[model samples]
Target: MELSNSTLSSVAGLQVVVCVVFTLIFLVGMLGNSLVIWIILCNIKQQFSTVMLILNLAVADFTVLITLPFWIYSFADGWVFGAPFCNVLLYVVHCSMYASVFFITAMSIERFVAVLYPFAIQKWWRRGTIGKLTIGIWVSAFLFAVPVIDQKATHVEHPQCSLLLSSYRQQKGLIVLETLVGFVIPFLVLSICYALVAKRILKMTLQSKSKSMKVIRSVVIAFAVCWLLYHIINLLTVSSILTKTSSPEVSKMLLNISERVENLAGALAVTNSCINPILYAFAARRFQNGFNTSGIAKLFQQLNISIAEKFSNESNIRRDNFQTSV
Candidate 1:
């Protein structure tokens, strides 16, 4: 069914709702990610690959959350920010988006390695090497975001920011590239890593695993679901654009429906940034133990899950050394 002008007004109203919702998400994300970063930096004596990965992920999420105010404002009002500023902000958003994906995927790979080749990790994956790799990931993410610089701000009825090129061929190419690189490949890698980890976990008793493992599983599942919906909507929109060749009217209808759905898909995609810290609060034993004095700690403590096995294992090692010296 074709939507009338009233339906277009409803879409605008939904965009306003998106602004309010995104603002709330930003506040919560900033608080949660900051706490995660603080706990990791202040309390941890020795940094491991896991620590570095989590720290980077928190930083990336924080960076993304910070840019959200501009987006919220632009959604509610028009894009008052000039083209250069809009482009820069969009670039930051894209970089952080990909960085989150990379870091999450890295976490899964790190877990898979830890579970599958514990001894090899110490030898093959040095902390310094992992740190360097994290830097490389950030640099690559920034490079991936270079396409945003081409986006220009236009003011006709109202100021709007959009792609400079409106060619159907170029738009299709860019969308296909984004879907393949941004969504498909990283997601596939994440799934495979987690599948291997899950296979290994199944061999062990439930009690033997860490609570953080379950948290990781949940994060992966959430990422998959949210981004899967986001990308499906994107593909549908792209298909609709392609259909202009056969039937312009049908294409216009599909595009209108896609536009109406865009807010929900975008919200789902942005939600990944807000979920990481909550996962840590509930599932990460070290986070609970390290921040014991805080209110958040109380919340974490109430979560009835086993402590991470690494903490207990470290204590065991210390006790063994003490006994050997005696």
Candidate 2:
């Protein structure tokens, strides 16, 4: 009886912790993303491909975060919301998640190209290519998220909003699919693009030793850190489904541990939505400082300037230096 009481108490404690963490995330994400949108729209009078991507990302992050209140209540109490509503909520979340990932990847690739082939990016901008790309991104995000509508929260004694796939095979498939599309593919793209950007910055002597590299590393590392645990735990679940254990007790034990950690892992993943605003601020601090010093007008002028033009001039300088050295 004492052990039973203690077990219940521990479970209650964990539930409280989950609720608290999620609540904070919801508050912070909404505010931060709102500020990002406002700055892009009102403060920064000039729009560019990079700014457009940032604006879309902020919108995506904010849209998904709006669902957090419902989720938090689901966690704190239970999933009182009907099954139909659950599906709708999941669809929106999935759509926003896909959009957020794509935009971040798009931004990274854009930056990479700006450093290597600045003129091409400029020509595309003149031709309004970025606007078309943005439309395509949203369409793709919505289409990719359709499958998630079938997700129904697990119905139990408490009716908690736990996303349990319909079948064991389905579970594995969804986990693999989401991990690949959502994190792995994007992670690889971000890593490669940023690494190249860092290298170019070094070659051009753009920023002093290691500064650009550090920011590049942080961007990749932050992306990895946010989603890596969730994927690992999910992959483990897939492995467990495939591998049979001799001891039922051991299997049950492993299952229990994964169950507890998986929720926390999921929370960590949601955190990525909120954390991007912070990373963006840090990454653009130099530009932001200029805007700050010169006020709103300065920001407007600076943001209006084509990033590709600056890189083009820098590349020309490097070309000149190389020729002179020869």
Candidate 3:
């Protein structure tokens, strides 16, 4: 599978294209997600389960955007960051991916609970509890990605970071683990949760229809579609590993196709971050108002007035007390 100079140049050109696409997606995603965070923290008052879930989702997306420069550099000049930095970068990237999936699944569950068992939420779903669960999600994602840290390495000769195990047996095992734990399990959970949520929304009272169930459905479906494509590509990669024969040329072609598909899927995954803020703006009335002029401006004005009043009252009280003492 040795590459000639021309072939190497061609691959470098392809990588440059990928780098530009990913960088653009990452920048737009960062802006949109940061706006979502600001709107949630500064303007939104209700702080429901859905809000918390959205916050966590934004956090995961932000984490990935923060690490994008490292990946962009890797694509541009190969993995010159050495083995340790490569390991850390891969670990962070995978951790963000896992965390993103888990948070989306959590959002589905929260929607299901809010729609189906609204009364039960008061008993179990508090802000503190959701915060704790978010922490657990981060910890779980980090642990899940620990194996990748050990399994990934930078190839000094080719200057590419990739999975360490090139052996068929090891690759098969890793692919199985990745598919089951990383994709299949999370997808199943999210699908079931969304199913229940849809059923609940359908059966809800008239007031519930006026809510943002339609928007929620759209967001969930978009995420599911993106992840489904990613998982399908992963399945193909696994198939490539399993069907590997002694034909070097055929094997190289299959590997190249798998790698290209994987790059496309990764790009699609980054698109998810950008989609979320748009979903929020369009789907939820609160988010729309808070993100726009009326709600956010009014909130800042009210805050400033309250602070001024508090200070004025304090000064008045101090003067009165001083006069009385004199």
Candidate 4:
């Protein structure tokens, strides 16, 4: 579809605004998620299946945030980076996206299992098993993104780098693959797990209704909202690609709108990183207390105390020497 100069300018302006919003969201998400990881690893002593899932989710978010500057630079100046860097960046971004979705799905399943079969959890869901599963998820995500790495680069006409699937055939293939692998499969898994979790929670006795259930519900709702937004944007993008003979002006306008929607959804997805920490703070009493009396603060306190004690010890030694000599 052909776009007029004015329409192109408008699209560029919209892209810039979206990029700025994404940058801010990425920065806030990185800081909040990093702190969550620190609190979990350094301060929290007790680890459960939920904590394991959260740790992996934080790692996935961190990986995406680490690559945000590369994308921000590309968006600002067009993709000045060569084909190789573009390929790597696209690969990493997709890897993180898939990893985040997989981790959330896994968390939902874990919650379902814990709720449905609480007695068997200690026997079946040990830390070692979780570690192995986490490694497998990372590996699978990296492999799934391989095609994206191969297909993405800076286009000859458009200065920006993007997936090289502009043709009808290529775009259809990508859309099908992305819909099935990226969204449909994960969404199905999460939905099933959530349904079971909800069923089990509903069956619980009134006395069994607890803070943990509330926390799980919040996380599940947040994850569902994020993915639902992403899925809607993806569907619109697919529709734009499939419809032929559409008016150039209309198509361009639709494309612009889709781009903005996709960007906003992406930002919302990243917000999950920050929201997890808040969920922990509100739902987990132990986490709240641990954050308050964290080892990070304790480390600084210990250093000061040690320095004062050393100085006092040296003074006492000098005083004793002086008294003996006198």
Candidate 5:
């Protein structure tokens, strides 16, 4: 469809809005993740598995946030950076996305194990297990993202970076793979984990678990809110493709609609990167009083779940009674 000059002008304005939103996400995500990572590394004393998981998660989020500038430029102008870099960016972004979700799933499962089978963890779970799992997550992400390498390009008019898969089967398969591996499996795992955790915690309340778990739980919810739309759009695209079997015009229309709505979905997917740090800040509750050091920094020192065990016997309800002030 050819855009008239007026339409082009309107699109240009909309592109500016997209760029602005992306830039804000980039800045906030980078700053928040950076601050958390720095404090975790330099300031926080006790480095437990939970902390390591968080550090890895922040790094994963940060990796994707760093790639947003290229995307912002791509949206505002075009893919002037050439196809090679575009392909690399696609791989990194995709890999990081997979890594982030996998890390969340890992954290959830770890928390489950810690809650249910404490003895197994005490006996068999080594300190380096999470490190190895971190490595495996990156490797698995790379393997999952391998298909997209060199597949992205400036195919359409105005040179936007897009996935231009050559085969219909490949496109359908990519959607299926993403839906299953990225969304469905993780959703099931997390739902089951949290269901059991909630069952156990019903008597315990949020106070029974450390705020670290609260932060992780909030991150899981944010991830769902952000990426759920993207996956739904992916399913709709698959539906469109399947609909072509009977009604070509209807399929074309559905495809067009999906395409139009897809930009916003993609933006939300990246928005999850920034949401984590904001959740971390809230979980830190750093603004409650004057602090000599970073409130976020102080939250890390007492992030362990075991620290909450002492509260199991207490009947009085006060979640913030022991809150630290830097």
Candidate 6:
């Protein structure tokens, strides 16, 4: 049932390479996320619900990005931080991850409402509403991350940090809860919202629809690519552990594979943290156009103007034209 000598060697080799790759990811992610936060903060005019959500997303991403060095060190040198610090760091990372998902989901919902129910969206655009939603998202994310606090640093065959479960039953239960709440539910809600948005877009005349909608799609796609495999690997790895009592040999083999896959998946997950800034830069016309004269600063200032006011103004102009025709 033991992992073969060759398998152990390969796992070690993969770990070394993954550590180097993750080190690069950490560097890039930190720079990208910091720039995002800086850009948003400078834009005093970027005060709408969308901007608020994005600002919070950048903050969440930055929180997680700072944790990458710890992971990089762990992957390269093993977990030397002991149990308490490991649990604390794990909690922070998970909380940030959950917050990132919630904020992205909020953005998706906002875009959906803005496109399909523009009139009603005005009522929801109040600072009070957005502020409450922001607080709720962070609070919920923190609550969901409580399970990660149970993870412990272990020195079995090698020093590493992992879930502190005493049996496969506990690990299985925890991973299932995490997979459902952390991945499945949010993704489903986002998919439905985006699907409705896309349907409405299709009904509009090609010339009337703006390319800004593409930004939503790109962000959702980035999230999926980054986190889906990692969740799937965790699920399978946990299931393999459940069977380890009957087949320790097979379980050990699968565990080794999972470790390798997790490394790759973990890197991709953090890589997602840096991608939103690039997508926003390319997809949002206003953001792109304002880049020269401290674009973000101008954008933050623009946020002070409610999106509802813009829509109302446009409606008034149209009404005036109709009145003239009469």
Q: Compared with the true structure, what per-residue lDDT tens digits does model 3 show for residues 158-259?
A: 445666665667657766776787678877887788776676556544433324455456666777767676777767766666566756566666678777
| Model 4: pairs clashing at backbone N, Cα or C within 3 Å | none
Candidate 2 C-alpha RMSD relative to the actual structure: 4.0
Candidate 2 segments exceeding 4 Å error? 151-157, 206-219, 244-254, 281-308, 311-326
* Residue 115 lDDT, candidate 1, scale 0-100: 70
Off by over 4 Å in 5: 1-3, 124-127, 150-157, 205-210, 290-293, 305-326
How do the residues 144-225 of candidate 6 rate in per-residue lDDT, one tens digit apiece? 8886675442222234565566666767887887788778988999999987877777865432234445656788899998
For model 4, how does the per-residue alpha-carbon lDDT over 1-326 read when each residue is reduced to its tens digit?
A: 35688898987897788688777867777876787678668765655566667778888888888887766776677777777777777788789888888888887776666666654455555437777788999999988877775544324224566776557676667667766787788778877877767766675543223345565567767777776777677777667765546666666666777876766787776666557656655454433355442533333233223323433544676789999999
**Regions of candidate 1 where Cα sits further than 4 Å from its true position:** 1-12, 151-160, 205-208, 284-326
Clashes of 3: 0
Q: What is the C-alpha lDDT of each candidate?
A: 0.72, 0.74, 0.69, 0.67, 0.78, 0.74
Name the candidate, 4 or 5, with the larger TM-score value: 5
TM-score of 6: 0.82
Candidate 3 vs candidate 4: which has greater lDDT? Answer: 3
Superior by TM-score: candidate 1 or candidate 4: 1
On a 0 to 100 scale, what is the lDDT of residue 221 in model 3? 78
Flag clash pairs in model 3.
none
Model 2: per-residue Cα lDDT over 107-130, one tens digit each: 788777766787778888899999
Tens digits of per-residue lDDT, candidate 1, 136-242, equal 89998988877666643222224345554457776687677678777899888888887787877777554535554665677777778778877887787788888
- Model 5 per-residue lDDT tens digits across residues 125-220: 455676788789889998998887844422433447677777678789988998899889999999999999777665554452656567779889
Least accurate stretch of 10 residues (summed lDDT) in model 1?
298-307
Spell out the clash pairs found in candidate 1: none
Q: Worst ten-residue run, lDDT, model 4?
A: 299-308
Judging by TM-score against the true structure, name the best candidate.
5
